[model samples]
Structure formats: C-alpha cells, structure tokens
Target: MIGRYIWEISELRRSHHGLTLNELNERWERSSLYDGREIIRKTWYSHREQIASQLGIIIECDKRTNRYYIAYEDTIGRPDIQNWLLNSFAVGNMLMQGKDLKGRISYERIPSGYDYLTDIIEAMRENRIISISYQSYWKDEPSEFELMPYALKVFKQRWYLVGANVAFEGIRIYGLDRIKNIEITQQKFKMPKSFDVEELFEPYYGVSLVDGEVEKVRIKVYDNQAKYFRSLKLHESQEEIKTTPEYSIFEYHIKPTFEFEQELLSHGESVEVLEPAYLRERIKKRLEWSLEHYK
Candidate 1:
C-alpha cells in the first residue's frame, strides 16, 4: 500500500500537482480504505522516510498549505522503471476492474508458462524442428508431428504457429490453442532463408496463404458496401483503377484462393466481379447454389 501511495504521488507530480488532500481523500474513499481521511496524513508522514530510503522517491508536504507532492524527479527518469510505470496501469485494468485499478493484486500469468514458450523461441532461433502433439480442424485425431515453428503470431484472439512439416511438405499454419503439447527436439532444420514474414502475407488477407501463381482480380463494389471497401483494405496488393458514381472498381494482384472468394461472397450482391470472366462464372454458380438453400 505504501509503495502504491508513493508511486501515485510520483505520478501526480509528473502531471503537475494533481489534487489537494481533500479531493484525493474523496477519490480514495470511493475506491479503498487507503484513501480514508483519518489515516492518510499519518500514513504519508510515516511512509515518507521509508519511501525515500527504499524506492528513492521523496515525498514532500508544504509547510503552509499542507499539500503533498513528490520531490524526486531525478529518480523517475530511469528508462526501465518508466516503462514499467507506463504499462502498469494498463496491466492493472485488465486484471482488476472493481477496485482502484492500481491497488489490484499482481499476478504473473505468462511467467508461469515461460519455460515452454522460451524453449520454443530458442528452438526457432537455433533453426531446430520441434515435435508436438498437433491437432486441428481437418483431423479429428491427435498425432505426433514434427514442425519447424518459424513465426509465432497472435491474430484476432488466438495464437498461430506458422511453419512447414518435416515431410518436406508445403507451409502449414497451426493454431496454438489447439496444440496439445510441444517438445523441442535435438534435431535442427534450416528455416527458409528466403522467407520474410511481412512479405509472405502481403497479398493475402487474414491467415490464408497463396501457394500457387498470383493472378490479377478486378471487382466492382456498389451501394453503401463501396463505403465499407473504401475504409477497410482487403489486401495490400489492391489498387484502385476507376470509379463511377454508383460503383467503385478495384484490382488486386493476388492469387485467387478459396479464402479470397469467400471474402467477396460475404459482401453478396453489393460487390460484383468485373474483369475476370472465369471468376464471374464461379461466383454465379456459388450464388445459385446458395439460393437453393432458401428454396
């Protein structure tokens, strides 16, 4: 509690003498007993020496006005401590929302699982293949598979492990949530030196990768759906060619995968296939099949 008080006083000094004792007391009474009026003055006076000795933060109370302020600006400038103080509020908010955000209990959630992930990161760094009990949507069974975990990425709300299987197979993406267990093996493999994570996903939207030849695709958007496409970018490869009053035309130089088609279909009639006649026919067939469900 004393540590938190000193930290808060230091923060107040950074923000230019925030609140008077009465105002701070009002704010504290709403959140915790630490903010109570009876003990606050006594607590500050007694804790000041201890705070200065332990944390190097000197708390000062003005003689005439009796307002409190932190006097140690020099100590607050440390980079490591500054970074911790900056992110501490955000961490506290996520952990505890009911009480005062700062006074919440500190818990090391990720530190508990650090050993496994650290080993995995080290294996990736060392160009080693890991054997893990991998499970996914395609297979109902859990089996041992050797994977070269190249990039670990968190997208949406889940983590994805992207790499190739030891069978010299194509690049595969695995959801970390579904990974039952992992063990870093002694066997080392070469991560493709040619691969760049940013460039790998440039043409594709979301997690899906385009393995085949890239193709140029043109689509026309109509109605308010054009507004949706205007604000939201589908792919980095997309280029705006022309626009009519009622429609907007966009060309994406990317591989036409199942994922790309699904995205277009999601917007329905508001979006149309323009230049590629083959893609138009495919969309028509899918829409026809979709309409049959209602019939």
Candidate 2:
C-alpha cells in the first residue's frame, strides 16, 4: 500500500507534494506501514524498494524535502509493463479499501492451448537448436521443423517464437500454440553478433512475414481515436505530424505487412491510409471486397 500510494502521488504531481510517513498514513489510512500511531520507517522503504525492483522502474525521493518522483522516462509505449503495474495497483487499492473486485474484474485473456514456452526459452538461453512439430492452420498436417530460437514474443494474447528456421535462410516466426512438440537438440549454434531483437522487429508490426522493402507508411486517424494513437503509438516509428479538432494525421515508417494492414483495419472507419498510394489502394480494394461479401 505504501509503494502504491507513493507511486500514485509521485505520478500525479511530483515536486508539489512532499510525502512523509504522516502523509502516507493519511492517504493509506491505518495500513501496516505504521504501528497504530507511529510510522514504521524501515518497513515502509523496504516495501517501496521491493515493488520498484519488481516493476523494473525507479522511484526517487529527495531526502532534504522528502518529495518523491519517478526519475525514469519513456514509459508510454511499453504496454506489458504498464498493464502489470496497473493490475498490481488495482489489487492493492481494492485490498486497502476493504473491497474485493472478484467478479467485477476480468483478467486479460491470453489464448490458451500452448505448452512450448519454457522449452523455447531454454533453447534460446543455451544457444541451441530445437525441433518442433508445427501444424499451421493453412496446412493439412503437422510438419517438423528445426529452428534456432532467437526471441519469444506475446502478441494478441498468443505466444510466438522468432528464430532461424533450418530450412529457411532468414528468421521466421512460429506460433507456440501451433507447435505440438519441442525437442531441444544437442547441436549448438551461434547467434549472429549483430542480431538485435529490437532492430529485427522494428520495421514490422507484431509477428511479420518479413517481406518487402521498408516504407515510410502514413495514415490518417479520424475522429476520437486520434487521441488514443497519441497516447499508445502504433509503432516506435510513429509520428504525429498534424492535428485538428476533426482529425489527426500520423506517419509511420514500417514495412507493410498483413499484420500491419489488419491492425489498421481494426480501427475501421476512423482510419484511412494517407500516403504510400499503393497501400491506400490496397486497403480500398480490400474494403470493397469485404462489402461484396455482405451483398
């Protein structure tokens, strides 16, 4: 509760408020941080440090004035960490308020029926190749493939493994749920010295097919959704070049992929493909074809 309360105060207004043991008691109201009337100094800071370390974030306090603030920047884009912290805070809040969210709270839904997460992680850690029995939805039967597991990512609530397929030249992404069996090989492989996870996935959205030249893709987000784009960017390359009360124009430098196109389509009528005329035409044709199905 001390950590959660302190984080909230620091986040809303940093220097304007200096939080001390008394202020924490006033906020949390008769928590474990105090012994009835006195603030327990050692235990309070110990809990704060524990929460900060777990979240991989820093919360700074000035001893001279006892004011607290978050010293870290660049927190907006990381949905995973943000979701975790928000859930943690919610649970703490409910407990302190003498209420249980229980049925009122629905957890983030992760697609089930995948079991190869640990095996792939260990293979990546050991720099070893793994043989997997994978059955893609498009195929009739399961196929065996050996892959040098590089990185694992969670997208749309499903886990995916990205690495070099032995039969394929470049890295390929395989869905973990589609993988039936995992056999870690004794064979060791060297990860390329220049293979950076971020750089590899930077030009694409979600798990990509890894085709085509990278383009400075641009799009126009109309109506209320523009505010959401400003807060949670579509990609690291996303830039908001124009804005008005009616609409906002966003530019992105991304390799056009099925995943990226589908993402844009999800926003529906609120979004339009603005630049890269070819991409705009592609979306227009797709929408026309979609309308045909209803007819």
Candidate 3:
C-alpha cells in the first residue's frame, strides 16, 4: 500500500515539478495508513525507479540543481498518454478549485446509495419536490423536510443537497449523508426567479445563502496566515490591504452568517475582526466567554 501511495505521489510530482522532499514526506505522513510507521525516504526513491521502469521512462536526477521533472519525448505522440495526462490534469484542477484544499483528505470507496442520488438528481431536473427524512447534525433531529430539489453538489468527498424548503418557503442546503429516507412527491416546485449558482455562492466561502444586504467588514490577519490566504482565496469578495509589517487587512462584502463567522473564528489569534463595530464586538464577546472554559 505504501508503495502504491509513493507511486501516486511520484506521478503527481512528475506532472508538477518543484515539490521538495520534505513536502513529499509530509504528504505521505498525512495519509491514512494502517501501519503506524513512517514511509522511509529510501522507499519513495526506490519506488520512483520501479515506476519509471514500468512506464518505460528513464528517471533523471540533478543533485546539484535540486530539481525533479519528466523530460522525455518518447510517447508524446501517443494518444493514450495524451488522454491519460488530460484526465489527470482535469481531476487535479477540480480538486484545486474546491474549498477543502488544506485538509487534503481522500476517500477510497464506492458510494453505496448512488441509485437514490441519481433518482433525486433526475427529480430535480423534472421540477419535483422530495419528501426526505433528514438527520441534521446541527439539531441531531431526524425530521421530515419537503425540499424542492434544485441542484446536487459534491464537496470534499461528500455530497450536498441544495434546494428550497417547502415548509420554510426558503432556500436550504442539506448534506446527503444526513438524509435518512427520501421520496419524490407529485407536487412540483418552481425555482426562485433568476437563481444562478455562481452568483449565489460568490459572496460566501461555503454553500450558504447570501442575502442582498452586504457589510463592509475588515479582518486583520498575521503575515504568515495572510500569505496563506493570498495564495488560496477564501471568498471572491475579499480584498487585501497592507496594514503593517506584522499584519495585513482583508475586506469582504459578505452577509454575516453563522458559517461565515465560524470561518473567521477558525483562524483564532492568527486573525482578528477590525471593522464593523457590531462584528468586532461579537467576536470580542465570544472570546471573553470562551476564556471562561480555559480558566
């Protein structure tokens, strides 16, 4: 299993060079391994040789240059290699576009209730409502919800159900795993007027609703954490302004939702609320209240 994972990492590194040895080792360590042993550096190097031999490509190394790259025109004209590279690149791009890049978690099993998912997707296309017995994590309650299914979204190895609630008469997002039972109803639903998925999720970081009202909120992040946010954009509405040598400011025009607040708080001391007195006070109060637990 370790050998296979090493081969996969080597393949990924070959496609995108400039991966350091430490980075490769850290990625392997983060993997879900049955045996609690570190993958030795020598093992990865040996597996690279095996992979090159199996693929009929010579592995070249430059110790002085400290570079690793695939540099051969042997099968450049082959359609099979071209198609393989295309599919690999497309998968990589999709993962990069997703929100859970840092977690880097992976699942290696076929989903069980795919038929049910397929039926719901088809019902959504047919403008139908679904009566679902959903188990919500927030309330831990298995309640029935008549959802006007709009679209299905997969994020971070999990599926999401996005639709309008028949009972609440508003939009809602549900996780597929939390659903206990689902049945398509005869009653149909018309989607909200001019509902665009891209426009809907533009202001928020996750799959959440964004009302028309926008708040100009300022957040201060440490230089190191700010660098991370610079490369990986959290929201499209985020704009950066340098504040000082130790910290920088990010401005966002977003609806202040519970999920958005959780995201900001996740950075902890690495980030702080700067503007919108109401938001700053909220964060400050939460910090003070949370301090009670530590004491």
Better of 2 and 3 by TM-score: 2
RMSD of 3: 11.8
The alpha-carbon lDDT assigned to residue 219 of candidate 1 equals 94
Candidate 1 lDDT over 1-295, as tens digits, reads: 6445544544445446545667655555654334334436666567667766655666676777766765545674454454454455434433443445465666544312233566677788898989988676788898788988887654443557788888767888877767778888889887787876667776676678766777789999986677788787788777778888888899998777776889899998898997578888999899999999999
Model 1: ten consecutive residues of lowest lDDT: 107-116
Deviating ranges (above 4 Å) for candidate 3: 1-116, 138-141, 154-158, 210-212
Candidate with better lDDT, 2 vs 3:
2
- Scored by lDDT, model 2 comes in at 0.74
Error of 1 at 164 (Å): 2.0
Best by TM-score: 2
lDDT of 3 by residue, 1-295 (tens): 4335334544454456644555555655654432565546687577667755554344455677564444454554444454454455446544544435566857477444454687697787789989999877777679987888887665445678888888786679988877888888889888776876556666666666767677888899996899888887777778897767899899888878777777788899999998889989998888888899999
Residue 137 alpha-carbon offset, candidate 3, angstroms: 3.2
Where in model 2 is the C-alpha error above 4 Å? 1-100, 112-114
The lDDT values for all models are 0.70, 0.74, 0.69
